[model samples]
Target: MRVLFTSTRGAGHFYPLVPLIDACAARGDDVLVVAPSALEPVLAARKQPYRIGGEPPREAMDAIRARAMSLAPDDGVSVMVAEGFGRLCTAAMLPVVEEVCRDWRPDLVLHETFEFSSVVAAERHGIPHARVAVSAGGFTAQADPLVGPVLDAYGSGIAERLLASPYLTRLPVSMDPSPYDVTHRYHEEPRSAVLPDWWNGAKEPLVHLTLGSEAGALPTAAGLYRGLVEAVGALPVRVLLTTGRHLGPRDLGPQPPHVHVESWVPQEDVLRGASLVVCHGGSGTVYGALAAGVPLVCVPLFADQPANARLVTAAGAGAAVVPANAGGEEPTVLDPDDVRSLGTAVERVLAAPSFRERARALADEMRATPSAAELVGALYG
Candidate 1:
């Protein structure tokens, strides 16, 4: 079988697609990843086959850079990166994605949910396409009223354009509803990804901390790293902190012996054996933990994170901390104290065992769904 795999512009969105791509390729099926030029090195390094598509706009890049870090976003600073950029990327990629799909004659189109244009391409070709939702927080398009109006408007004709299936199973990792559930829970195993080098098995209980792929990759992510270093100072647990691609050790300040900071780490590699996760409630980070049955100490930054955080808290997988120093009914800075409090929450989940038990149950439920590759076969065949 031949499959055309496409992901959103960022690493977080692209990384989740890797497991399925490799799975299909390993089974003697050809898989092609169509992405951006900037992301080419990322794909090459992973040894994943890919063709570069659109260049994600410098304006879009600058827009992301200009944005401030906060526990929440304002009305204008939506998670979807604004219509102009989406439209531009879609327009740019349509010809190339279509060309690759035509040349590959793919049996199915496996694409991240964010790109409606991919759906359009598949629809135009009358092919089946599966939505691999990269983050659970982005699921609000199906529900949230504030976002309902626009998503409903732009998303109106997707069903006709592409055959929809909850098939491309996202990894069931994170703080809230597992990634499998994000795609409607149709898989049979929790998907896994390649690990980074820093993840070594050690006797000390490992704690994984990250802000996320894009937002965490920010220059200011150092602030959170410093906070984590201070918060976990002298704690018994060993810490693995990924600062994302954009930042470095100097940005993170001096790291304590207990905390090991890096530009990146194989999250799943660490999460699999870790005791707890401290993170911004980005769906990738949150679900990554959940897939491993590790409880979360979540601080949601924006978008669907709050919803996922709610799910995590409700499911007894972990606790939610809104930065205790936040005032005037809402907060701007994510308080370090709240993250420190999260240690207590982690202890509760670790010591009680019930939280971990419940989390593992969720993972089992998540694993009952079919793998993304199998779904592609079913949907396209």
Candidate 2:
């Protein structure tokens, strides 16, 4: 069987499908990935063969951003889907996906949840399709406003038609807050393990800090990074901070002796030995920490991050501080002045053994879920 995986260019959007791709290949099934040209380097690094799906026009992207900038903080996720990534990316990818599906004749069209274009293509070609949820719980509740606009753009009822597809969730019910009520497949943490050279034998607690690739690209991110640096400075733990490919050393001014900053690092390797994580509440990082039995200090920036952070706190594995925007509607970016507040939260997690214990319990639950290989077999059988 030929399995076609489609994704938007962001690391958070594309990375979740990696393990399943590897699993399919190991089972002697053909696998192909479709993403934008910007993700060429990332896909190449993984040695995953892929085809280039062109990006949205510049005007469309600019419009999306403008719409997001005008939204209230509480409406960020809804607007993001209604005006930004969901509609625009789907429009951009539809042509490429349709063309690829026609030529490839894939038996299954698998995609990350946000890529609605893949759903359209699967329907156009009469192929089975499934959605892989990138976050702990599917963000369907937050996407309610998005359905109408997205469907209207393509055609009436397009959104409902697409959402009817099967869903694969990485998180178990114990961790998921708004779990999707559909045909669901569960899998353990899908990241492959690694050991990087940076793992020195340090007795101090290891804290890994990152905002993931997409979150780091936002204009508000520089301030967030500075705040994180300040927070880490106040702690005694040894921190390995990764500034995604979008930023460099110049972006971050000074750092304390305990903090080490790099453009990027092997996340799986770093999470393997990390005692705690300070992150922007991206799904990949949240699940990665849980899989490694590490607690978290989540400072949520826009999109579904606030929702994911809430779930972490609800599960007893982490603490969250939702930054409020001027609109006073809800939380948005991490205020740089909240550095000390963030530091206090980190210290609390460090002092509390319960957080770590909860994380370990969730880790065991994740381990008990079916493996990606098993899911692949069942999907094709």
Candidate 3:
């Protein structure tokens, strides 16, 4: 079988598809990935075969951001998904994706949920297609109404076909609990990488702090990072803070000996040692923490983060400290009170045994799901 995978830019979006892609490749299926040039480095690092697709123009993105920023956070997210991902990104990549489908004639096309171009192209070419989940079901539920109109604009009835396609996910049913006949659960293996030299020497009750790759590059990043640092700095436990690619350790200024700052680290490795995770509540980070049976203190920044945070809290595995006026281009700064609240939440999670117990239950639920390789064999074998 020939499998073609498509994704939008960003690690959060692309990473979810890796397990399925790797599973297909391991089974000796011919696999190709279609993504923007911005994702070249990531795909290259994985040694995955790929083709570059169109990227949305910067001016167009700026215009969209400006428009979305004026509305409330939830409203702003709808605009970003509807106009940015559903419309602009699809319009930009559809031509290249169509060309790839025509030339490659893939037997199956799997796309991350937000990447719509492949869905259209695959449908047009009469190839089987499925959407792999990148966030919780609630996020999808919220996005459908917003993006449905955008997809319908491409062609009448296109939205119905695309939305009704097979849905694959790693999220445990307990975490989402949404009923969808097309949904299939797959086990996503934890990724491994070389840990820092200090990793072995880190103390117990370790805490991991991260805002994901994209959030650290936002305009409000400095305030957010600073707030996170201050919130956890005084604690006696070991704190591993990853600044992502855009910022360096020095950017956060001086830190105590217990707080180790780095540009990036393998999150799975960190989670293994972490007693708690304080993060921006991106689906990847939230799921990783839960899969490891580690609790969280979510500080949602934008996009689907707020929804993810809500799910985490609802599951009794974590707590959230959402930023005021979230989801705007120029969001409000994190004040001292907000920092204190974050610190308190972190302390609360660490002190409570129920959080870890709940997290462990969720982890067990995830482990019960079929492995990605098994899913691949069932689908294609």
Candidate 4:
């Protein structure tokens, strides 16, 4: 079988497809990844076949970023769907994707849930397609009010596109809040934290902080990092901070003796022994913490981070706070006040044991789901 996978140009979007990609390869199926050139290195490292879609126009890129930032704090997630992130991305990659599909004639077009462009292209060419979830639960478009307008804007009865796919599997057990009992679970890959030499002998309570790759790049992210430094600086606990690839020790400013700063580290490794996590509420990070049974202090920046933070709070696994200048139209620079608030949230999670207990409970539920290998067997069984 010929399998083609697609993702929006980011690690979070691309990584979820890895297990499936490997499954296809191991099964002797020809698999190809179609994405922007920026991701070529990532695919190359995996020895995966790939086709670059060049780059989206600067105007389109600017429009996406502007719309994302302009969204009201309360409406960020909904507006993202309503504005059609998937449609816009699909349109941008359509030319190359279509061309590739014509020549490759893949039997399946497997794409990340947010990368809706591949769905459109797959449907147009009569290829069966599947949607893979990047977050804990496959996206819940039906739960959003703007689903109709969003679908219409993208042309055709496109809302069905979300419904048609068999969820690439099902929700993480904790995210499934429905009273109606549902069976069938897809177990995710386990996250094993890599404890570096510095962390190996630490006896103090460890607090891990990360703002994810995208948010950490914002000019304002520096403030949050500094705030985190101050928050844990005087505390007796050890601090492990990852500033993403775009940031360095200098960007984070001065760090107290208790703190350890790195441009990036294996988060799963950190989460393994984390007493608590301080982070921007990206779904991948939130879910990673929960999977490891670690409570969180979610300081959301933008996009789905806020929504994911809320979900973590609603699930009883964490506490969330919005940075003061986070959703503003102008470039946000977190002030001392914002840092104080962040510090306070962190203190609360660390002080409360219920958060830890709740996180453990959710982690148990997550482990109940079928493993990726099991899901692969089910899919091809």
Q: State every prediction's TM-score relative to the real structure.
A: 0.80, 0.90, 0.96, 0.88
Among all windows of ten consecutive residues in candidate 1, which has the lowest summed lDDT? 325-334
List runs of model 4 lying over 4 Å from the truth: 74-84, 135-158, 169-171, 177-184, 191-193
Q: Which stretches of candidate 2 lie above 4 Å from their native place?
A: 152-158, 177-179, 188-201, 324-337
> C-alpha displacement of 208 in model 4, angstroms?
0.8
lDDT of each: 0.64, 0.77, 0.87, 0.73
Per-structure clash totals for the candidates: 19, 0, 0, 4
The model with the greatest lDDT is 3
Task: Output the better candidate (3/4) by TM-score.
Answer: 3
**Residue-wise lDDT of candidate 2 within 192-227, one digit each (tens)?**
566444536556888888988866676777777877
lDDT for 5 (candidate 1): 86
Work out candidate 1's RMSD over C-alphas: 4.7
lDDT of 3 by residue, 297-345 (tens): 9998777888899999999999999776565556646788889999999
Segments of candidate 3 deviating more than 4 angstroms: 191-194, 197-202, 327-329
Least accurate stretch of 10 residues (summed lDDT) in model 4?
176-185
Model 2 residue 340 distance off true place after TM-score fit, in angstroms: 1.6
Which ten residues in a row are the worst by lDDT in model 2?
A: 324-333
CA lDDT, candidate 2, residue 73: 44
Predicted candidate 4 versus true structure: per-residue lDDT over 166-247, tens digit per residue: 5663345556542222234565676575687574576889999888887776766787677777766777789989988778
